[model samples]
Every structure is written in C-alpha cells, then in structure tokens.
Target: MSLSPFRSALAASTLLAGFCAAPAFAQHERMSVIANGEKVGFVDVARTGNHVAVQYDVKNNGRGPTMVEAIELGADGLPVSWTLDGKATFGGDVHERFLRTATKAEWSDSMGARTATVRGTGLYIGQAASPWALGLYARALLKAPASTLTALPGGQVHLDKLGPATIGNVSYQAYAISGIDLSPDLILLDDKNALFAVLDTGGAVVREGHDADVPALADLATKLTAKRYAALQKRFAHTVDAPVRIRNVRVFDPVSGKRGEPVSVVFANGRISGIQPLDAVASPSEALIDGQGGTLMAGLHDMHAHISLESAILYIAAGVTEVRDMGNDNAFLPDLMRRIASGEVAGPRIMPDGFLEGRSPYSARLGIVADSEAKALEAVRWYAARGYWQIKIYNSMNPAWVPAIAKEAHALGLTVTGHIPAFTNADAMIGAGYDEVTHINQLMLGWVLDPKEDTRTPLRLTAMKRTATLDLASPRVQATIDRMVAGGIAHDPTAVTLELLMLSRNGVASPSVAEYIDHLPIGLQRRRRQAIAPIASSADAAGYDGAMAKVKQTLKLLHDRGIRLLPGTDDQTGLSVHRELEIYAEAGIPIPDVLRMATLGPEQYMGRDQELGSIARGKIADFILLPGDPTKDLSELHRISMVVKDGTIYFPSEIYPAFGVKPFVAAPKMTLPAPTPKLAGSGPAHDAMDEFVY
Candidate 1:
C-alpha cells in the first residue's frame, strides 16, 4: 500500500523522479505536511556547501510514530546517501540505507542488499528523496533529454514537465514524476525553481507559511492525476466491442461452496442475460470466446477499503469489482466516487461509509470530527443526508455517546459499524446498538485490556501480545460472543491485518505476501518483506505465533456460531484481499466459505444482493474469469484471465505494466472478424485479447 500521509512523509520524499530544481543559496526550506487542514508532519530542506540535505520528522500519535528520514545529495544534485529509520504503519522497524558512487550504487533496505551500475548521469537512490529533488532532477533532465532513469535498487523512473500552474495568487511551473503505477505525482515550483508545494493523491505538502493553502493545492494535484488516469481509462477500456459470450467455464456457486457443471454465460449492457449449457453453440451475431474450462465467479467486495482511484483500478484488475470504503478524507472520497460513477475513470463500484470520530490530539484526521453528543448526531445527519449507507465510529469516540450516535444513525436508516471505542468492549458497543464490529483486534482487545488502557495509542496494537494466552471459553470471551450472535452482529475481522501485526518477524518474508509480492513494484515489494512488529527474542516470536493462533481460533469460533464473517483487507489493495481470503482458509474456514464471504456475504450485509453479488441472469455483470477453479485452491483467484465490471472488460496484463509490474500472464488471444479496426495507439494495435478502454 502507498504509505499514509505521515508514513509518506517519513518513508520516501522523492516519489517523483528525474526532475531537478535550480541551485539555490544555502538556506532552510520548511514545508508542513497537512491532511484535511490538520498538520500531521513536516519536511525540512537545506543546502550547505556542496551538499543538499533533506530531513523529515513526524509523530502521528496513534497512527505513524517514530518516522524519521535523512537524505543528502551530491554537488550534482543527485543523492549521495540517504536513510529512512522509523516504524512502518503496523510498527515495523524500518532502516533503509543507500550509498552512491560515480560507477556504482549500493542499497541496504527492507529487501536486503541491492546494487546497480551507474548509467550516464542518472542517480541510483532510494525512493525517499525530498520534493526539492524534483526541480533539481528536472534541471538534470532538461540537459540530458532522457525519458527514464534507472533507480539503484531496481525500477525505472519517468519524468515529464506539465507546464505552468497558478494556485491561488502564486504562479508556478508544474512537473509530473512517476515510477510505475501511472502515478502522475505533480510538484510545483516557483519562478526561481524552488520547491513551493507538492500535491499527492490524498493530501498535500506546502511551505509552513502556506499551510492554509493545502486544500486548494491538493485539489489541483488530485485533478491532474485524475486526468492522467482518465486518459488511461479511455485508452484501455473497451465499451464498443461486440457482445461477449464466454463458453465452457465452471461457475462457482457461493451458496453451495462448489463449482457447478460447465456452463456458457453471456452478458451485455451491464447485466447478465443468459446461462446456457456448455455444449450450446453461440449465435453468429455473438462474439464467442473460449474459457478453456476456467472458473467464472462473481467479482469480490472489499468490505473495509479506504479507497483511492489508483487502488480501485488495482482492485478491479485483481478481480475485486466492488468496494465499501471504510474511512477516508471527506473531501476526496466523494469526488473519486463521482468520477468512477461518471466513467471518467475505471474502478469498482463504491459504497461510501462515513467515518465519525471524536476530536482529540491523537484522532485519525479523516472524516467528521465531533466533540459532543450533539456534534456526533450532527455528523450522523450529515452523512445520512449525503446517502452514506453506514457510519463507522473510531477509537477516540466517547463510549457514553455511542448509544445516541448509533440511535440517530439507525433512525436515519444507516447501519452502524466501527472500532470498539477506547475503555469499551464489543459487548458494550453491541448493546449500544452497533450492528457490527470493524476489526478482529477491536473485538479481542477488550478481553485483554484494563479499563484505563487507551486504544488511541500503539498500545491498542502492542496489547495484542496478551491475547496469546486468552481463553475463548472463559466467561469474559463467551459473553461477548453470545451477545454478538444474539444481536446478529457481523464481524469485519480484517484478519490479514492481525496476521501482519502479530505473526510477521523482522527479516523473514511474510507468508501472507510471499506469493505475490515479487509481482509488485520494487518499492512495495521491498516494504512487504519488512516486519510489522519487531521480534526481540525467541520468546517474542513465540508470543507472536501464539497471539496469531488465538485470533484464528476466534475467527473459527465466530463462524461456527453463525456469526457472519466479512473478508476485507484494511491494509493494501489488490493481492492483499487475496491474502485475506487465504488467512480465512488457514483459520479453518473452507475455501468455498471464504470465497462466499468475499462475494455474497458483504453484499447481503449491505442489502444489495438483488442487484449484485451473484452470476444469475438480471444481476449486474460483475465477475472474473480465472484460469483455474478457486473452489479447490483459493490461489487460482490470482490468475485472472479477464475481469468484467459493469460489462466493461479489463486485462491485468495490460494494466500491470502501467504500475511497473510485470504482467502475470499473456493477454488473452481473441478471434476477430476481417478488417479489424485498430485501436488508436501504436505498440500492439491488433486489439490483443480484445483489450478495452473505458
């Protein structure tokens, strides 16, 4: 996953590559990182003698703590050395070091040792360079005239000048820096080529004096990225193609947890129209495509997605066709949904979930922040008026006020789900009218914590170590389970998060990501191998193992009691959801049941079963065609041949390259009629596998 604002600030400062700025006199340049008008962190830039230095310091209180980075550039404005020493989102110890010389560059990061030869004037550095590096890199690119430069650890960096932009009263020259993922990270420069501001996907970084201008600048950045993705969607989505009929595929029955007999499924105009016997021949007018005896199943629903347009595309490419956004920047989520709905971008259908939290210094800064019961009710009415299907409470919320908040939300027809507030337990929230609990940790933490322990800190996570010895049959645990069962309370365990937190050890590749990490961009792949929680000794490792086992045991018990389990990845998008399902399977839930939880379970919970979550005729044509049956081995879901979302086709092979990922499979070969009309692009114009654009 792309780091959160605080992690992004501490992780890598140089997300944009190849751009260089003009040399400036020795001075300090301070930029404050702001999210939703709240200051989360800051980056400091300075040039002393012949070296350019950048430093970042931020403590997101409950979120990202102990994030610090130091970077130094050579006289040529290229990185000479850099290090990011901090804790990852799940509290992993991050110690990334990079050193460069004239002939070679060396790096020791989360993924271990890596080296690359010096090619031309290109600098091989870690991705953590500062925004100031953009202008300096631009200056270098202007002189060299190269489209891409190789990074030391691996991957190509593409840079482009987007001309000029004027935010508020200030004028600026704009440039886009991207490395894989088609992320057009736009950084703005003043007339003197000084790094004035950087607008990333969700938030922004502006000079300290310009803190108030973050919203406007971030909006501009969001639009530029949107336009870039819009062009990509237009170029890749296939809407004008002939009706597609996929024949000779086994359909997965979520109801029965088995694959039905081979069948022919045909759909167009965004709705399934027919399901014929596998032996039936397609009409001459229909475009017949061979499934090669693959399995066809409904596209998945990510019940706890904190969505972004980029993640949305990744989800669709990974066969997750629907998402229910758990929490996000109030300003960003609505517009992103609007773009997706208008077909200006390619993504899964989104169900917006309003995030409600109490105002506190350690509060998660997204969503509506309320300080009193009246304000909480006001937030509920606001979300209801705007059509939010559900409201999610957060850690800093007052336990005493949850009843009133839940009552107002329920009265307005919104389902209530969220973290059990600090100093409270799952049973208290369930009794207060919460219909669901958000995470497995939230449900289990109460059984282990003292009444005074505050969850608004890392203690909420670290306290999980105590769960290793928890007794599920004890009155304390059984009471919560009994209440949840009787109240029809659903659980969005986000089990992969627990696995990442408790089971991952430093230097040992996490099993949850080992299967697909290598397929991601180098930056992400490297980060995935790092531990989330440091294991100090054999006892610590054993504690982690025991803690993870208890959580798995909790999941199994909840399922046995008929408490609904909704599979969701609260971590990164795409393959993480796949891994979440695998965690479920490891918890002893059958493969078919896991698949059902990802597909039909959330749909039924959200009350959208009539229009989605199935492959029957009249349902929305949202499903994936995989090369193997997932019923036998859930891993087959990763081998997606094609994903049809709302009747539009997307090929993972074509989309992967945009993000610097090697395609997992060859684009499906298609049989077309004579005089094949070519797509407007150059590389391969034969419409490989009928590649479509939105």
Candidate 2:
C-alpha cells in the first residue's frame, strides 16, 4: 500500500491525525454537496499560496458503514496518486474481496516516492477518477470465485457487465473472459477493466450472486472463480498442535549446554512444562511415546527449503522441525502458508520471502521484474499481503533500491536480507537498513576480501592477493564488525555455501558434490543436479585452499566478537548440514561448538528456547541417536541410529542416500568384527586423486 489514497477524493483527510508529514491546519469543517437526491461527502479546504490541504469523509446513510477502496486522481488525469490496497472484509460476510488498482498503487510525481499499505472490501468498479461514487457494505455475498475452467459447462469468451448493484452493501463488475485456467487464475485488467494478463493460480473460487454492479455479468464472475480452496483448507487443518510426551531418553539440551544424560520430557498444550529423570515419569493426557533410551535433542532447522510436498514430507521425516524458505513465487505464498499452518499437509514450519529484483537478467524469472523505485516499493507491498516474512532483495537489485526497500520493509514489520550484487556490498546495506546479511561471502566481502572472481570478473592482481588474508585485526575491519555487533546483525554463516563457491576445483562441484545428486527428485534429479555438477574443467585445488583461509579468518573474527552465527546450510537436504559442521571444523570452529551451532544456535536465534532447541525436561522431543558421540568422531553424525522430530521417529543411515522408491531397512546397523590390517598414512590410499588439499 502506498501513502496516497485510492482517489484524490479521499487523500485530503486520511492519515492526517498526528502525522508529522501531514500539513498543519488541515482540519475538517462543514461543507455541502448534493447528488442522486442525497448528500454524500465534501472536502474542507485550507491553503497558503501554492500548497493546499483538504479534509473530508463519507457518511453512510445505509445501515452499514459505506466502504471505499480506491480514489484515483492526478494532473493530466493520469491517476498520479492512489491508495487502493489491502483486501476488505465487512463483519461476517466472508466472500467479499476488493482490488483498488491493477496492482498496489505505487505513488510518485515529479517530486519523489513513498510506500503504502492498501487497506479495503467488496466489489469496486470503474476507472481512476470516474466521477462515480458509491458506498459498499454486504450481508450475503460471494462464496468463492469459480476457479476451475475445465469443468465449467461452456464458454466461448463471454463479455458481461456485472454491477451498479448490491448484495447487502458491496459492489463489483465483470467483463471479457477467455482462457480462465482450470485452477483459479488472476487476470490483470487495465482501468477499462479489460483483461491484460491472465495469471495461473491454485486459488479459491470467488463466492457470488446476481445484483446491480452488473446483474448480467454476475454469473461470469462466478464462472471465472472455480478451484476448491483445496490448498488453503488443507493448510488450515494441519496447524493444530497436539500434546506430545516423550519418556525415558538421554537428552542433549542446547541452552543448558548439557549432553549425555537421560530425562523424561512432557509437552502439553503446546509448551514444554517439565523435564525430569527418566525414572520420574508423571502421568499426563497427551500423545505419549517412549524414547527407549535413545538420545533426545533440539529440533533441527534447515535455513533454506523450497516448498514442495515431497520436500516438505522429507523435512519432517529427516527430523527437521522448521525451515526458512528463502524465496518462492509470491502469488503461491498465501495459500501455501494457509495449507502449512492448517496441517492439511505434513511439513516443517516454513518462513517464506517475496522476491525483490532489480533490472537484471534474472528479474522476470522470479517476481522481481521492476524498473524504478516506485515499482520496487509496490513489489514489496504485493508480497507483504501474501505473507512473505521478509524482503529477499536479490542479487541484481540497484544499490539505491536496497535502502528504499529496507526502509519500507522495516516500516511494514518485515526484515530485509539476501544477496546484493557486486554494485552493493553488505556494509553499505547494513549502514542503510539491512537487518540481516545472508551468506558468508557477503559478510567477507564487506571487510575481509574482494572475493575470488570468475571468468567474467574484472580484477586487479593486487586485489586478488588481498583476498588471501582477512585482516581481522585491522582497524578498518574491526570498525565495520563493531558496528555489525552494535546493530545486532545476524550472520547466517553457511560455510558450506562458501565451500561450494570456493571449490570450483577443475569445475567439479566439490569432492562431496556427486553425493547430494541422488537425493533430488527422480524426475528432476538429473536436470536440476546437472547444472551444479562438479566443476570439472574448473580451477584446481589451490583456489579452494585460498578460499578456505578467508573462511577460517571469518570464523575467528565471528568467534572473537561473540557474534551470533546462524547454522544454516544452503544445502537443502538436512544431511548436508552435518557436512557443513565438518566444514565448520575445517574453517576452524572447534567440533563441540560446531555441533552446538547446529543443535542450539538456531533455536536461540528463533527466540523459541522455552519450547525448542535441545534435549531436556519439558523440551519438545527432538534429537537424533548417533552411532557415536559427534564430539569425537564428527562423522558419527552421518551414521544416525534414529532421528526423532516432534517425537516422530525415522532412521535413514542404513539407506545411505541411495535413490530408491523408499529408504530400505535391510537390517539395523550391526557392529563389525575387530579391524584387520592397517596402512601407513604417509602413503596415498583409497583415492590419491582426492588428496588435493596438500
């Protein structure tokens, strides 16, 4: 929603109360206006020279409050200003929805720019400043828009006008329909209300009835809306949190920093109220299950996940309780959120972001296709309504747009984080308004290094040399870090992402690259995995080692400052996270702390310590039983005996990531006979080809 109102008619007086930006002395007064045999509303004016302000309001003569969604006006009649935003709801009427402008009305003039939250209800018709004024309210209204076009009786493109009508107290108009997707789709119309773009969606149908806005056209609107709010209804049902109890388990609590202990855990009414010794179990009415002496720990969180049924199911199966979805199609988000929360589907809790792009080649591929500052602001609002938790400003956004979008996101209670291109670095974004800077490279690029460039990079030989050592002790680097600390900026140090970025070894993805390819969806496993396959023909092992040096320096700097490091792996499958822990050790995080980084560090960042992030009395039952303590043989984590997420159990180690219809349980892992012969480490064994690190 932009700061301006839908029309010049409403802008004068709205938002004037105590607004520092509003002009002074713009107060309401008595005024008269007559039309259609009744008085509606009029503007009260005050002016000093060229600047003037007006105050006004519309009074409903009808039983309900007259609702208005838009008021467009501007010089040359181009609707230079509009405040059409946010959907409208009147009391108990559920089907009513509203749209003020074709898109969120982003405001600008020869002057400058500002953002708005389009806030409205009911059917709204006509062009900007149409001279047609009406109040809307409703009793019985639409049920759902017709969303499935395939099942409809018949349709040769139909053109019908819907309203100047009312059902209780709302209005709407419908016209020119062709190619309504089987799933409910959105059709972008120009001011003439003629279709400009038809967008496919898994949307709920619009509820409708015959009335004035366009009686003959009412049925057409109904036909246009079809799909079952299947996605939404499914999501809404799953949000229920059932009571769970886990008894007799050794717990590893992150906050308490405790491990290797047995405890009885109880969860009821969605909160962990107690944790006692395994022998001290108390009776409670909830879903109680015995942990059977297995180790219990905090729920694992994946920093990045793309929403898909298979992926979501796998997240829960893998013991990941929550995930942060970096970016996805904005239009699909609202219903997606509803479905996830309703528990209509089984998946980890998700946090989504709306795409924010600049004038880059990748713009339209995501929802970021924007050109100007105003366009960028509208993109933010467009996603804001759909439930994106943050503004994921992408790699190609203009440096200037970063500050503007960040400010708007803050104002809207949204955080800004993501990759900014070479044009804008982390320091400037943080100084401007970035709340969190993502990826270790961005963090490093700000103070540590110029970064290892690719074939397209234009670099100076001297700068390349500086990329080796991050002068953490340097005053300049410390100063920037100090500000980041003072500002409470969270660093999602995905060390694995950096490993991939740095490991262009002969262009093979990495030594571990081919391993993850099997975990991908069969239909897409090859196509998608091929793009990132090992960097064969790429640079050699030396480049990887150089990158590791900065990564190590980054670790020391973050450790010294006591900065908050979110253990996130851009690695989708949670297994990659363990690999990340190993890499964390390589980058120099002591193994114990690195383990904590995965188990507890994330919970504290989530601010849900009371309910999650460890194995202890009264904690949610989440933890994995490893073949051995990860503190000793860090690789033991790979040999998980059992994994419990929210108390549901799964065992995947025996499966060994083989791409199968299902992970097989051929037999539980068994202890092998005593080791046989040993070989000298001074000589190359298994794959001498893999010993490039030396």
Best by TM-score: 1
Candidate 1 residue runs with Cα over 4 Å from true position = 1-10, 14-22, 51-54, 65-73, 83-94, 111-116, 125-145, 180-184, 240-242, 672-694
- Write down the lDDT of every candidate, Cα atoms only: 0.75, 0.45
lDDT of 1: 0.75
Cα lDDT tens digits for candidate 2, 20-139: 111122222223322112233333333443322333333311111123333333221222233322211111111112222433333321112333333221122211111122110010
lDDT of 1 at 451: 85
Worst 10 residues of 2 by lDDT: 135-144
In candidate 1, what are the lDDT values of residues 189-240, reduced to their tens digit? 7877667877766677787898878778877878787887898798667663
TM-score each candidate. Answer: 0.92, 0.54
Weakest 10 consecutive residues of candidate 1 by summed lDDT: 9-18
